[model samples]
Target: MSPRSASVNEELRRRSRERLLQATVELVGERGYEATTLADVADRAGAARGLVSYYFPGKRQLVQSAVHRLMHLTLAAALDREPRTDDGDERLARAIDAVLGLTRTHTTVMRTHMALILQHEGFIQCPEQQKLAALLEDTIARWGAADPGQDYRLLRALLMGAVVALLLPGAPMPLSSLRAELFQRYGLAWESGCPPNDEPPPRS
Candidate 1:
């Protein structure tokens, strides 16, 4: 049989890497960081144990990349979810909801991811992270930022802060409250973007 083409080989590699990343997310999120080992992730991915280190420097790095990929995919889906729109306000609202919604559903995973980012090795620079950043930047631009470049940074910081706040242990704030503040800040109507099934925040 002829050797596989270069493109085919590249596609295989991409699939392998994606499987590893996804396995990391599932294992780490379900089992927490320390409990989940590289071997476990490899096994879960049905990949060779050696392939783990070949794809990622360590479990921490692997988990970070995986979580970032999750974040990117989550946000993307929210932006294009049912009842989609191109309106700047609605898009921005969707972006906010997408992220804040994660705080509710993926609390444990995101808490661990944030802790690693804040207290440990700092931001892991990977293509997945860059993609997440680019999408957020685009969200800010779509929101009609007068200076999207600057506003993107601000938006990122705010989202990070909100996540940290939402995940704060023993004193975690309410997602509804955080959503209220974000909506108010961006002049977004409370009814926007698959709004929660709770009462609307009171008007000033």
Candidate 2:
């Protein structure tokens, strides 16, 4: 067989790495972070055990990247879904719902991700995280922010706070309440984005 071209080799490597990340997400979501190991992720991805270490220093980093990839992919799909528009309000609303939706749909993954990020290590600073940040910055820019960078930070903080609230142990708040607070902060209508219910939750 002929030797693979440089581009082909790179593409193969990318696919391998992607599989590992995906496997991490699935295993972690199904079994929680501690229960899932690097060997298990590699086995699930059908890649070599050493490849996991080559792509990620450890299981925590791997899981973090996987979750970040999930976040960016979910946000991208929501923003580009059918009937897509350039309207700032709609785009911002979609972004908010997309992130918030993860808490409900992937509770284990999101909770683990949030806990890791809050630890001393902070963000993993991987490419997946960069992509997620870029998407959020674009959303803020579309939403008429004079300073997209600053506004993106604020939006990120708000979203993180909401996720923490929704995932809080023993005293978790209602998703609708958190969503309503976010919509109110951005001056969005209750009907915007994918509202969980018809009427907004009553406020005190």
Candidate 3:
């Protein structure tokens, strides 16, 4: 080949970055945050170690972006799954379930992500995070919010709080309870989205 076009180069770089992010998620989930290192992530991604540094300043930022990507993908899948519709209530319900489900499905990665976010560096503000934010903001707008931006912030805070509650060491709250509270807050029916079980969570 004479030369790789700019578009081809950009696409290659995107794939490389995505591999690193996926590797970070897998390694962190398997080995926990402390045990997982940049080299380890690079090896898992089958890319050079320097590539990780080129894409992220440090391990923490890498992990955060990975988890954000995971969240965005999960939420997108839920929203776009079979039988999809534009019903605001259903979409909001799906969004809540999507984030809450991560605490259970990707426990280790999500826990590590939450911890990183609380540290001095705060959120990474990367493309992955922006994509996730955009998805949630769209969901809120579909839910008939007067101000989707403000509502997205509130929803994000609530989801973070709920994740903390679910992952609180030795004192984790019941997922059903958290789900119930969120559904009630958003005026969603108990049966909407992916309900953990039937019978409306047993009203307290």
Top lDDT: which candidate number? Answer: 3
lDDT per model vs. reference: 0.87, 0.91, 0.93
Residue lDDT tens for model 2, 1-204? 345687788899999999999998899889999999999998999999999999888877898999999999999999999898999999999999999999989999999999999984888999999999999999999999999999999999999999999999999988888888888888888777888865465574
TM-score, one value per model: 0.94, 0.95, 0.96
Residue-level error in angstroms, candidate 3, position 25: 0.5
**Predicted candidate 1 versus true structure: per-residue lDDT over 61-107, tens digit per residue:** 88889989989999899888878788889988988888888887887
lDDT: the better of candidates 2 and 3: 3
Clashing pairs for model 3 are none
Off by over 4 Å in 2: 1-4, 198-204
Task: Please give the range of 10 consecutive residues that has the lowest summed lDDT in model 3.
Answer: 195-204
What lDDT does model 1 reach?
A: 0.87
Query: Candidate 2 has which clashing residue pairs, if any?
Result: none
After aligning candidate 3 to the native by TM-score, how far in Å is the CA of 113 from where it should be?
A: 0.8
